[model samples]
Target: MIVSSFFPGRIRLRNEVFKDAEIYAALYAAVGNHPAVKKIERNERTGSVLLEYIPEKLPINKLLALQSDLLALGKLAEFYSAKNKPEILKKIKEIESKL
Candidate 1:
């Protein structure tokens, strides 16, 4: 996790999985409703997220871990599976040629 910015009530973080819309949607759905979370914003082009939260309700390090680890592991698992499966590899190569 790369912390691009930090202040008392807000933090902006950068991570590779943050560029994935799927991850963004999941993160927003997972934490958007928490009382500590005041607001959340994302920039897909930069793979970055800006989170505004109440420190009294949620600690910053916990937020950082939750943001960086959960979906990243999912992406890593996806990469590992795709690399191991020959059937998926052929289809991926085929699609890559078309693109």
Candidate 2:
């Protein structure tokens, strides 16, 4: 039951469980014989876990703009303080006018 990966010296663990068709048959037989993990007789098929809410993809341009805005805010915060609110507001207004 050797499973090869692109990266060297890596063998997937599942290969040991389902190595070949013969192993799969043996596993099914063993599980069927065991009372603990007995086969279910369901009419409907079950599905894997899935995501309920999917988010919209953000554009690269918008992402870059957000990053730039964050950097500017960080720079402004470093300069501005509670005691110097008036000066900070004046500077921000001056910058806003330029923009």
Candidate 3:
């Protein structure tokens, strides 16, 4: 995943492809509700996520960590199988707890 500052209050995440639309949908469901996030725009063609957020409400460090964790989850999804579903879900829960 590639993460960079896009604007004063925006961040761009690039190259985040998943195995399929289902995994992509799951990723959004997991991270789209961050309290500090003002808006989220996903580019399906390029597998990128653009985030606009309130710095005061959510520190940059926290946002970065959250995005990093989400990216990791997405990568894991690429190799998802019935045997690993439970482990993946547990990890997702762990990441969510931090948020």
Q: Considering lDDT, which of the candidate structures 2 and 3 is the better prediction for this target?
A: 3
Which candidate gets the maximum TM-score versus the true structure?
3
Using lDDT as the measure, the top candidate is: 3
Ranking 2 against 3 by TM-score, winner: 3
Q: Single out the weakest 10-residue window by summed lDDT for candidate 1.
A: 90-99
lDDT of 1 by residue, 1-99 (tens): 467898878978786657766556765666677788899999989888898989888775665655435344434435543344443333333322322
Q: Note the residue pairs that clash in candidate 2.
A: none
Candidate 3 residue spans exceeding 4 A from truth: 4-8, 16-19, 64-93
RMSD (CA, angstroms), candidate 3: 3.8
Q: Is candidate 1 or candidate 3 better by TM-score?
A: 3
Estimate, for each residue in 1-99, the C-alpha lDDT of model 3 and write its tens digit: 566546557877665353246545655666678777788778887767787878888776775777766677657656677666666666667676887
User: lDDT by residue for model 2 over 1-99, one digit each (tens)?
Assistant: 121221221112222223233323433443234333223121112211111111133233433554544345335445544564444344434333322
All models, RMSD in angstroms: 10.9, 25.9, 3.8
lDDT, residue 84, model 2: 47
